[model samples]
Target: MAFHAHPDDEALATGGTLARLAAEGHRVVIVVATDGVVRDAPGAALRARLDELRASAAVLGASRVEHLGYADSGHGAELYPDPPGRTRFVRADPREATARLAEIIRAEQASILLSYDVNGGYRHRDHLRVHEVGRLAAQQTGVRLLEATLPRELTVRAYTALEWTGLVSGHNRQALQHGFTPRAEITHRLDVRGYARQKRDALAAHGSQLRKGRVAPLVRLLIRLPAPVFGLALGREYFIEPGAARTGKPSRQIIPPAGQG
Candidate 1:
């Protein structure tokens, strides 16, 4: 089960990995913590976004897609008020959220639970809350834990270059201050280059966000690239498992054998 903070996060972060696993006959599932509803997009727009999410999941070959039933926690210098009738993920009770997520983990009998790293990739409050809640859910369910993250050195170098190239905005660059996990700290670096098509298709399925400008410009550029170029850019996904020693090289896969943890 892969747990994400929002709709497109699964695709942007681990879509290729999920596609590969699903294609290998593994039952892949995606669980998101929020509706990705930061603003008051028309009700129809929100419904369409959900539909798009399901479409994306189908493209990735996921067996199930579940939402934890929370609202988005807006990001940026100015905090936006939560939409009426919904609680932002950052404001939700962590214990309650974890309990609900634990139920899903138990129900799925999932061996692995994917969440976000300590820094939540860019210190997004909702993503950080996801990290905390996901940890608790793993502890409660005894599922193996894997947190999604990028290699710190890679992120810094690549983004710095992108900034220099004028591809990244100052605001987005500033958000990277919290940092990603160093290469030595990453436990898995699954290569999903072969399933890039599935990843790309899944990413495109979230058309509303792509059209509405919900994702970062970098992501938009990636999705718009030719298939081969897109694969080359995001062929691998990185992860860290708490308490696990870093291997000399990244593991090709995340799941252990049926009898293993």
Candidate 2:
């Protein structure tokens, strides 16, 4: 099971692993925590993107796709500027969201649950909330949790690459001012090079979000890199597996549990 704050998130974060897992005959379901309709676009444009999400999910080979029906709290803006809104996920009760996620976990009998890291990777408020709710759901339901993270070394390399390529600008620097960490702490790497095409196809599905921009080309390049080169470049998909027995205090050595295969 994969839990994400929005539609494109799954493709960006775990499309490769999800595709690989489904190809290997494992049941992979995607639970989108929010509707992702809060982009800088018109209502019709958002609707089109929502449709694209479904198409992308099919291409990614998800066994099922479930939506928690929460509204996307536009990034960098409070969901409610005046009074609170019921649709805004960030404002929704945490326990309520967690229970909803727990129900999905129970229904699917998911042995492995994938979600974003504690920092929400780039600190999007909804993403962070999804991380919180996802953790609560996994804990309550006793499902194995996998937090998506970037290895520390790989993150540094990516940042370096962006800087060298002149892609990391003042805006990115300002965003990182909050703080950043090594991606390797999560510990599991899924090489998605083989599924890169599918991942790219999935990304392209989110047309509203993928407006003509510099980021699109960068994303395309990142996913299109050859598997070996990409692996050497990005290393692996970092993960933190919950409920695994530890020989020592929690460190970055965690691996997916045996049965998850």
Candidate 3:
């Protein structure tokens, strides 16, 4: 199962891996911690985001999809007020959140849970919460945990390329500097080049993010790239095991063999 902060996150961070796994006959489940709604933000509706997430998940071949029932805290300072009855994910009780996720882990019988790195890949409040809740829930359920991330240097290079094409207009150049895990710390680097087209399709499914500046120009540029260029740039996915076993050159599988474990 892959657990993420938002709708497009699965497509951007682990889409290829999820697609590859499902194509390989493994049951892939996509779960999000938030509905990714901010009432004041343009084109950011809860139902729209959830629909987009389901569409994206379908493209990635996820057999099932779920939300943990929380509101998007959004990025930057000044958290928005929670919608009607829901609480902002960042303000929810950790133990309660952990329990909710733990229940899913048990129900799914997942062998491993994929989530964000310790810094939540950019320190977004909701992503940070996902990292924490995922780790705790996986532990509670006796499942392995793989924290999805990019080598800090890779993110920097990506931002630079995006900047050159003006695709990252108004985006911070140094945003990738601090939050990602380092290359040396990454335990798995799965090559998903063969599934690049599917990955691209999955990303394209989240049309709201692409239309609104919510995700901005970076994704816009990505979907526009030719197949080969997109594959070369984003065909590989990264992850860290966080104290889990490591043996025999970081196996390519997201869920390593039982012997390896």
Candidate 4:
């Protein structure tokens, strides 16, 4: 199960991984935590975007798509005063959200659960709530794999070095400026280079939110980067497994390139 805050998030963050898993015959499900109404897109426009999401899921080979029916909590200042009749995700009861997600996990019999990091990858309030609900649902369901982004020490080091050398530019700088957490704590890195094209196509399917002119080139560039470079130094997806037995020492679940098998 891939838990995302909104429609486009699954494409942005886990498209590659999800596509690869589905291609390998793994049953994959996407749980969208919100309706993504923050952008002020018309009701019909949002529904169209969701239909696009479903189409993208098909391209990604997802077996199912689940909507938690939560509302998008607009970014930062926009969240204040709770927009008229719109549902506010930040103020939604976490317990209720967790219960909803937990039910989905049970229904799907999800062995693995993937979600954004605690920082929401960019500190979006809805993203943070997804993280919290994911953690709680994982605990409740005893899912064997809980995939999430963690702050990666090496990524931080690389960013710092780049900043010192004045090489950080474009989107990298924008990421820094916006306080996005791109360097996550990686635990498992699946080599998605084989499915990179499918991932790109899946991303493209989110037409309403991802305008082709704006994101296509960047997606192309990202797909072209060597797989090793793509995962940064971690070169593996990361996760924190709940209820796993601890041996009084950290486990070496972090997959190196040679260990991707």
| Candidate that would win on lDDT | 3
What is the TM-score of candidate 4? 0.73
Badly placed stretches (over 4 Å) of model 1 are 214-216, 256-261
- Model 2 ranges off by over 4 Å: 39-43, 77-86, 164-168, 174-184, 212-214, 220-235, 243-261
Query: Least accurate stretch of 10 residues (summed lDDT) in model 3?
Result: 252-261
Model 3: per-residue lDDT, tens digit, 16-44?
A: 99988888777899989888875553443
lDDT of 4 at 113: 86
Q: What global local distance difference test value does model 4 have?
A: 0.66
Candidate 1, lDDT over the whole model: 0.84
What C-alpha lDDT, on a 0 to 100 scale, does residue 63 get in candidate 2?
72
Give the whole-model CA lDDT for all candidates, comma-separated. 0.84, 0.71, 0.85, 0.66
lDDT string, candidate 2, 175-229, tens digits: 4444334542444556667776667677767775655444665666665666566
RMSD of 1: 2.1
Instruction: State the lDDT at 218 in candidate 1.
Output: 62
The top-ranked prediction according to TM-score is: 1
TM-score, every prediction: 0.93, 0.80, 0.91, 0.73
Superior candidate under TM-score, 2 versus 4: 2
Whole-model lDDT, model 2? 0.71
Q: Lowest-lDDT window of 10 residues in candidate 1?
A: 210-219
Cα RMSD for candidates in order: 2.1, 4.0, 2.7, 5.6
lDDT of 1 by residue, 1-261 (tens): 999998888998899888887877678899988888777767786777778889999999999999888888877656577777777888889998999899988998997898999989878888889889989998888999999999877777677888775767566665675566878889999888888888988888887676555345666777888888888988889999999986588786887533445
